[model samples]
Target: MIYQDTFGFAQQQDEQDELKSFRDEFLFPQHNGHKVIYLCGNSLGLQPKSAGQYIKIQLDNWENFAVEGWFMGDDPWLSYHKALLPTLSGLLGANDREITVMNSLTVNLHLLMVSFYKPTNKRFKILMEAGAFPSDQYAVESQVRFHGFNPKEAIIEVTPRAGEVTLRTADIIAQIEDNADEIALVLFSGINYYTGQLFDMESIVKAGHKAGAMVGLDLAHAAGNVPLQLHNWGADFASWCSYKYMNSGPGGISGAFVHERHFANDKLNRFAGWWGYRRDKQFLMQPGFDPELGAQGWNVSTSPVVLMAMHKASLDIFEKAGGIVPLRKKGDLLTGYLEYLINNINQKQGEEVYRIITPKDQKDRGSQLSVVCKRDARAIFDYLAQNGIIGDWREPDVIRLSPVPLYNSFTDIYHAAEGLFKALGATNA
Candidate 1:
């Protein structure tokens, strides 16, 4: 397809998109009797039209079956989560036994840490990216404190070189090798939330294991945005929230992955509850806990069926769209087009007024582009909001825009650039 600076080009792209019909499945917000250009899927995804129906099915089962819904209905409440396993596993590139949907994002992070971050005097330090999400920082700090270690001394953070917005894989691997004796764990976001940088997961996992350290990932931003091979990469554990690219709605249930290697290893310590007990003997109310064989054993309570219903609705869409590969292909083209237009604007303005902090190479980033405004950042952001362009602004000066392939169009990218140019002109005036 010949790229052109016209809405017709986006219309042509949409016409050629095999997954374009999927956009109708979402509930797009409206402003001034028009559909708002939503570029914030990196933050919260649009709700699926099927979500209401999915929830209603569960509500009906709950109202009619009442207490008996746990075991009696066609899709019993107890096994409702089982229906989602195949789809979730496919998305993570993991075995069914290694993946499960449960808890919120931060809660799952702590639970996975409990089993994986076993620190001792000789190798007690945890290495992580320098600017991890605040919640992750808090969780790791509390986990360190729980073991009676000072976070300042026990947490080792890897940062980018001066004037660089993203971390280099070589630097990360080198740090692991240098601290091989002191580091007990390596936990990083599969994709950095602010910079949209996709970390080298396979190499990092290999390096950590070679150094005798366990590795885990907080995939909150990476989950549906990029293709992952958690099982093949031999990652020790991982966790992710579903509300962003997965379109599971706000505060939807999250998921976790525990490598099958740990399934039979009884020595792997974890915080367990009744739900984690063996299913056949759970009702026996045994004196001791014999955990379930795999990732399901990580569950602490009954699965939330209502939230799972919404998640299942989104996964159904993913299945119909032919999984992540095709979507990622379209994502690359869409985001690349956005980058092209933005750089063109910088040239026209005669100075670099806005800079994309995300890496230029598609291999190093996901769908998001973090634009750093040189001046009048807030005013430019406010103008975009008033003009019906919906992207998110991080603290200080970054505005994140993600062109999700499932719903966003190339025209969305074009209009965003046009709106930004107008906003910049207004600020100067």
Candidate 2:
């Protein structure tokens, strides 16, 4: 698709968009009495207009049924999360039994590590991408320490070659082979948070397993942003937060995936709780932790009905929008248009004013473009914010602009580019 750097072209594309109607399902924040151009879905998704009604339904059930709402409501609180599994299973490309909506991301990561990250005196190291999200870095470090290994010695980060912004799949596979003798686990994010580079998870899983290690993924950016096949890829476990691309609201409930191949493996350990106890005998309050049949076994506490309701509201939209396949189709075009416009700005300026660090190929990225401003980065970011073009800024110099497919429009991307161009003159940098 040819892209033009004019507002008219953007309006024209918006007119032709098959998913254009989805933009109305969300409630955007206002700036000076108009809707702000929201390009920060990489950080936080806009609220779904139907979220309130979903929550209110559960609220009404609570009010009317009192404590009995656990079993009496339209969606019984006890089995409420089950309703979410079908859509989630489709999104993650796994069996419904392999998925469970549970705690937040990092917490689930730590819990999964307990079962997958079993290190020994000789094979006690974890191989992961360098510059992983801070929460993941901290969790791996603490887990290493808890197992009596110094983090400095137990952690192996695969860094890019000098002057490179992304990892080559060959380098990643070679690293796994090089460290095979000692590596106990291969942990990675589906998409790097900082550079917006989508990792080749299928290749990573194969390499890790061949190297005699378990594989896990942190899909916070990738779950709703890209396609996944955890079961088919043979990933041992994975987890993701719902607040960002999944758009379940701030601190929303998270989901975990455990391949069915591991379900009968008794050697694996879990930090068990009654919520995960055998469902048939849960009401009996029996002793000895007998876990539920599948991924639900990972649940450590009762489901948070309110948060799940918010999650359901958003998942329902994904279903209506025909799942991630269609969303991804539009996302590629929207992101490509933004990259094209930003490139035009640099070409017109006769210098690289904004260097996009995200991969140029659509196959290697989702909706985000991480741009490094040549000068006055903070000032330029503030200018965009002041102009009601809301993107997010990373530390140091990068600005992340994500044109989410569910709610963002082509016009939004056009005006955001306009703001980036105007910021240069306004900041005088």
Pairs of residues at least 3 apart in sequence or in different chains that clash in candidate 1: none
Clashes of 1: 0
Which structure among the candidates has the greatest TM-score? Answer: 2
In the range 191-245, model 2's lDDT, one tens digit per residue, is 9999999999999999999999999999999999999999999999999999999
Write the residue-wise lDDT of candidate 1 on 1-429 in tens digits.
Answer: 356777788778888888889999999889788888999999999999999999999999999999899998889988888889888888899999998889999999999999999999899999999999999999999999999999999999999999898999999999999999999999999999999999999999999999999999999999988999999999999999999999999999999999999999988888999888888888999898899888999999888999999999999999899998988988889899888888888998999988999999999888899999999999999999998999999989999999998999888889998888899889889
Predictions in order: lDDT: 0.92, 0.95
The lowest-lDDT stretch of 10 consecutive residues in candidate 1 is: 1-10
Question: Which one is best on lDDT?
Answer: 2
> Model 1: residues >4 Å from true position, as ranges?
none
